[model samples]
Each structure stands twice: as C-alpha cells, then as structure tokens.
Target: MPRFFKQPFFAWFSPSPSRLQRRQLRQAIAHIIGDQPSNLDVYQLAVRHTSAAKETKIKGFRESNERLEYLGDAVLGMVIAEYLFKKYPFKDEGFLTEIRSRIVNRESLNGISRKIGLDHLIEYDGQRGRLMPARTSMYGDALEALVGAVYLDKGFNFTRRFILKNLLSHYDLDSIISNNTNFKSRLIEWAQREGKELRFEIISENGSSQYREFIAQLLVNDEPFATGSGYSKKKAEQSAAEKAFEKLELQ
Candidate 1:
C-alpha cells in the first residue's frame, strides 16, 4: 500500500507542492541542513505539515510533518534499541529496554534538541493560533525528523554515531545505573530516615494547547514544605523534592 494511503485524512487535505515549486524550499532547507541532502524529498516532507503550512491562493498547497515524524520515530527507536542492547550486553533485556526508553523519551529528546540548537532551525507558518513556544515537543519531534534526515543524508552508521555522540554520550552510564534515582523515590528515603510523612498532592494542573503546567505541593508530616511546578508530574514532584531537601538542609 502507498504510504499516503496509510496517513490520516487531514494529511491529504493539505496539498503538498510539486517537486519543481519546492526548489526554493530545498535551497532554504540546504542552508539550514548545512549539507545538501542525498534525498531532498525526505527533508522537504519532514518540514511540511498540515498545521504548519497554509495556502491563500490555491485551495490546497501545503506540507505536513506527520509522515516524517512517523518515519523518524521508527528510526530512533531502532537505533536506540540496538545501541542499548550492544552497550549493555551483560544486562538483561528489561534493563536495556528501560535505559533506552529513558534515553529516547520526550524529555530527554527535548533536552538533546535544545543542546544541538534544532529548535531554531524549525520553520512553521503563523496560521495556527499560536505555536507552542515551549520548545519541548516541537524540538523532540524535530530531533526524530533530524535522525531520519541523517539516515537518508548519510546512512545508518552516520545517524547511529550522531545519536551516540550527541545524545547518548552525555549520559553517565555509571552514575545513572548506580543512582537508579528519581525525585519521588529519593524523597521517600529521606522521609523514612527523618521519620516524617512526605506527601505530594496535585495543586493546579493547567495550561494552554502548547504546554501543560503542573503544580504540586509537598508536605512533610502534614506541614507544607514546598511547592513546585513543571511540564510533567514527575518533574513537578522532583522540583518539590529538591525544594524540600534544600529547606531541610539535606542537600
């Protein structure tokens, strides 16, 4: 079956431009991509999306990022899975899977995208009410698309090396494994040691379409110790824990 057939209905509604008309776009992309892609079509399709592209004159003439995102997602998962499996040969499948999940998850991908400055390179039209300026989801998607681009531009070897160097290398495997840590667990340990009741209750969790904000309160022995907010519940809890730890001088 054709890939287009597999795409959602909204995809076909947005018209993608002809190859000739996309020459200028390809040039713009070349500037951003830094190297001429071996396959410009893939790169162009990655940037096009129903939400981002719009047409005033023609009834339909736009691009969509959905397909690229889909392809990128598969590529990323495969590469990460292989890397983890090979790197941690002694570890069981479950251990390797967890680490891979953590490494390629939304938060981690967003962080890597920011570090490599992919956020700035993204191009989108202003037709949508307001693009999420949060930089996490967009950048994360872009990171995946970038992996797809790299795979097409160079090959699996190049893409694999890039992922390892840029994203995976930053992670301290030793520290991560030894710590096996997260804020909620750490807080629990502290509370147990201090003989205090640690509690995290959701306060206000709301946000616009671009982002979701979570507010959480930390209580120690029924006493509110700290308040924290973040894009995710876990992150919010972590922030609250840090604040509580600081207040208790347990840092």
Candidate 2:
C-alpha cells in the first residue's frame, strides 16, 4: 500500500480525503496506474476536470488539469512518435504520421480513457453542460493529465513504460494503420464539393513555451460548428475537424 496525505495542496485546498478515502485513493491510483505514486496531490489534480477548477482553486493561482494536459499532450506525441518511428522502420513519413495521429487523436483517446474507467475517478462538475457534454472528452483529457502526473512523479522513462504497458496495449497498431481517418482532408474536400466555406480558426493559445495549448473552432459557411483543443495549432485543427466531421455525420 502507498502512503496517504503526502502532499499539502491536496490536503489543504482540494477535497480533503478522509483517512479511509486517502487510503482508497492511494490504492486506486496504484491499481489503475500499476505503480504507486510519490506525490498524491498531483495525481488528485490530474483527475480534476476544468469545471471543478474553482472548487480546488488556490487563492493566488488557478488549479486544473489543463496545464498537465498540455504537458501530457506533448509527452504523448513525442513518445508515440518515437514508438511509431522505431516500430515502422520501413514505413514512410506520411504513414507513420497518420498512424500516430490516429493513436493520439481526441476520439481514440476518449474511447480508451472511458474503457480504462478513468471517467469514474474524474472530479468534475456535472451541472456544467458544456463541461460534461453527452459525448464528453473530459475522461480523455483526464487521461492526458494523468500521463502528465505520471511523468512528473515517475519521470520520462517510467512514463514511457507505463504508456506502453497500460495504454498502447489497448490499441491494435495494425488496425489503426488499416483505418484511413484524415478528418481535416475530408472536411476540406466536403467544403469544396458542397460549395460551403470551411475554416479552422485558432481562437486561443495559452501556457508557457514548453507546453503551449491551442483551441480551435471549426467554421462551416462562416458559422461556428465545433470546437476542439490540443497542444498545437495543427493538432487543434485536426481535433476540430474530427468533431465537425462527426457533427455533420460525415462518417
């Protein structure tokens, strides 16, 4: 069993887990992550959704998994890129890129996060409609945040191993390769075919240079249709396109 009440942030601001709750949280973290965490507070923050930022709000600063999500997004991209690069030594750049996108894309991660039961552990505001949409990305974002937490607590090498063992195992690389999901291209083509204007606008960009985050809104005939977020402009657009494509029922 892992130690409890290990960090001040969690003990003070966030929901104060009881002795039993702390024990349960520690056990849950170990069980879900397959390793005990050194800092319990960070892990708690990882599952914290943006809507509940105010609840765990620090007096002088903002608190949410958003920053960690950005870090994890970058980490995930790099680690997965390296994995695909080495795994497909003979494959072309486009092939590897597409496969990697398929793996890290919002939809794929959402499914994986839900399947892994990360949704249940997330501390979010259910009352907030947009924050908890019907088909929510909250769980997926939490997963990325959780990855960030792992990276912070255990470092890169351990995080890499954890991803390979826990996350990549849920995926079939061959199947991902077989599927052709170029949402951006498809959406552009649809716009051209239907004679409708399509644009992906970067509405916001925030965070430090190391882990900058992008939020994109998809426009159809100059109207906002869907929005998505990622660590890069291209990634944000890709995420936006995916959401728009699904919204349009193009699939």
Query: Candidate 2, residue 211: CA error in Å?
Result: 30
Candidate 2 local lDDT, residue 92: 95
Q: Give all TM-scores, in the order shown.
A: 0.55, 0.69
> Which clashing pairs does model 1 show?
15-62, 48-63, 48-64, 48-65, 49-63, 49-64, 49-65
lDDT of each residue in 1-251, candidate 2, tens digit only: 11221332133324555777667677778987888889988888888777777533556576889999999998988899999999989999988887888798777887777767666667766565464333667767989999999999999999999888899999988877776577899889999999999888999999999999999999898899999999999989999998888777564
- Can you list the residue pairs that collide in candidate 2? none
What does candidate 1's lDDT look like per residue over 1-251, in tens digits?
11222333223223555665466556655554455667776665565433565554667754456656777788889988888788788999978877776677676677666665555545554356465445326667877887777677778776777777766766776765664446678779977887888889989889886799998899888988899899988788888886775565452
Ten-residue stretch with the least lDDT total in model 1: 1-10
Q: How does candidate 1 fare on TM-score? A: 0.55
Assess candidate 2 and give its TM-score to the true structure: 0.69
RMSD (Å) per prediction: 12.5, 9.3
